[model samples]
Target: MSEPNVLRVEGLRVHYQTPAGPVKAVDGVSFAVRPGERFGLVGESGSGKSTIALSLLRMIKPPGRVEDGSVTLDGVELLELTDEEMRRVRLARISLVAQGAMNSLNPVKRIREQIALGLREHGAAREGRAFDTFLTELLERVGLRRGVGDMFPHELSGGMKQRVCIAMAISLEPQVIVADEPTSALDVVVQWQVIDTLRRVQSELGAAVIQIGHDMGLMAHSVERIGVMYAGKLVESAAVRDLFRAPLHPYTQLLIASLPSLDGKERLQGIAGSPPSLLNPPAGCPFHPRCPFVMDVCRTTMPPPREHRPGHFAACHLYETS
Candidate 1:
């Protein structure tokens, strides 16, 4: 029997309107998340990683809109839902630990109060000590002490603030957690701690997690499957071991090659050339400009996503072997 998927995104396109023109932040991206699966989305800055995350939760603010696509959670299409309806679904069903979430917390309110805000918004209890008890437990579960909940955001360290943010996101027992760069601001030790905590919470709660990170090394250990993104498109996706052992896309290979070795002396060589601006991306394959093995066809026509190996999919002219 196949595992049940908690979310499915199909042909998702997101664009941002700037003074100059429309920026195609996320163009025609598609993927899925199975229950209890830790799916990693890896890419450098400007690859639309965070844009995809925001679009998943319908949190794309003004100047940005999901121009096309269907984001289905369970059996429901979220893109069609109204703002009011989306609010109901945001935390109760599909929660998000967004980038800079520590800054999202209210400095004026106590941690307990901020968490309770989500509970109340999602129709969880707002009154009595019941909510307080739940908040305490969630804080402790995320590696914080119960008393930490009484402090304001300013009182906590950066890592502590992040823990509070995670606690709030999971307090509602959401079915899927979309964590965008969850460990971006932490030290090495704190990063591992947060990843471990996320893994532990995921196991105990049985919720699927979508982890978006640019660091291949961090993702190598945290996720079961990896999706590589380039210039707003999904370049390749495969199971964790397969992706590490034999990445099909040239971009994926280069990304993996850039990871720092345990020996700590070899100079890590990252990919050259900056990512293309979404406002006016390359004509053919979005990655064609940067792909070392780029062929003539890659410069004229976009490649459709195809199964390069069993369960491994890639979008590149190189894999269009008829």
Candidate 2:
């Protein structure tokens, strides 16, 4: 959907303080998510994809902190909000379906109580028959039976637990849902089911979704647009089909090339080297060491992002301004 942006992140930067120095988790990453759109952030481990998700919800802890930038949701500045104000923003405006359902769910609490926690925090708590009907409709939307809510986490299967989390995330009808690897550790069939459930609820609510995952295959078909992150920066941004068909960044190209083709004819290609350490990244482009088309300029000069095609942007020495 080419609707107005529901969320906008500009010049975002997050760092983790360490004995050696700061680990630049997110460095000047910027993008916008439109209403009813599914946006994916794909990257290798430690590439700051989840960090960006947490930053959006103001969840950075003690050792880690947001150093700069702004996060605006529907024209309201999130970073400027007070703690109490931010609490209200969460669940009500932007909710998260954590990567691990076991970790997010309370073993002692019934599913209804856990979900009710969000509603209560957002001051939308319901009780008795009212809550039962709401819970039934919510769980049904995620393809679960209403009685599943009265059961404890231990009674549910892995897939059901995840579906419960999805129910919790959408229960408040948030404007944006941050799903960080929602389908992780699930079987293929269940993965598809969970994704379908998520897509259905998102469409029903017309809420934007930020899908963070390392599974390029799932992301290829799930999201409308994708942002490729490398060395704590977004190296490329484009529509899903455009990015996969014609990845501009060297890292992104290598990533796409590494995917196994369904025909089983194309040999999987791998990147030559590993990603650079953010603690002391290379002087110029972090990817120049692994880039096949590295130039003299790439060794000492960081390439500024440039738009190479309509609605596609990349940071690489290969692309010159038109």
Candidate 3:
């Protein structure tokens, strides 16, 4: 965590060309991930967390494009690379564990065949029994049985399917892993198992991880740092302990307050009003309409992100006054 940043993102903006004008999915968001560190992106649905993931890997398809930004991996500007160059970079250097395991895997292909895709593409594939031995080790690394190499997607449980995705993600030992909701839709036990599996493999490979999810509780103990986003903008970013202990932005505070308390003492509260429409957000801060501490400056001008405390950054008028 003390190492220099392995991946740096700055001034990122991703927009979708909808019929009702362009929807700003990501608006000038910036953050960085250090080697072998676990970073979390937590926000409500439609807050552009997933969009930032897509933009990082240069996967935003037609209709949605990374308008302006700088994504550099080890000092190489990702935005400047050619399509094929970026293609080579993926899996070999950067891999993704998609949110939906079933959707990410091919139902028609067996697990062994599917796992071979990255190895083969990256020129590390072995044939016959040698390949079987390699595949078995890969599956075992993610807490899967050796027999799982012959099973299809439907045969595995939700957690197992996700573990399979993790196995595939680490086959080539990439430098970074982007896990977009890797534990969603699973029971508590299964979620814990999958998260453990992810952490184990990440440790063995020594890869930096960017975990994107809506579960703040899950993120609290699983990561070192957290970035909070709202309505296409990063409202706050800080160390996980500091973020939970002293939330800087209003949205961050409300989000933490909304989580159910384990002691059953504090009432679980929901934030008033819904997230703004990205197609036509408010003039100043998009979160101003829902914020309780709104001010004249917040209503009229978009607050630039500033480091309020050491390594803690927030975009809000309250800090400016303090």
**TM-score of decoy 1:** 0.95
Candidate 2 ranges with C-alpha deviation above 4 Å = 1-3
Candidate 1 per-residue lDDT, tens place, 1-322, comes to 3436789999999999999999988989999999889999999889999999999999999899999999999978999999999999988899999998989898899988888777877888666677667777798789899999789999998888888888888887889999999999799988988899898888788899999999988998999999999989998999999999999898889888877788768887988887888888889998888888988888889898898899899998886866
Give the distance in Å from residue 278's predicted Cα in candidate 1 to where it truly belongs: 1.5
Query: lDDT values of the candidates?
Result: 0.89, 0.91, 0.90
Ranking by lDDT: 2, 3, 1
Top model by lDDT, which number?
A: 2
Give the Å shift of residue 91 in candidate 2. Answer: 0.3
Error of 1 at 124 (Å): 1.1
Find the 10 residues in a row with the least total lDDT in model 1. 125-134
The true-versus-predicted C-alpha distance at residue 103 of model 1, in Å, is 2.0
- Write down the TM-score of every candidate: 0.95, 0.97, 0.96
Candidate 1's C-alpha lDDT? 0.89
List candidate 3 segments past 4 Å from native: 1-3
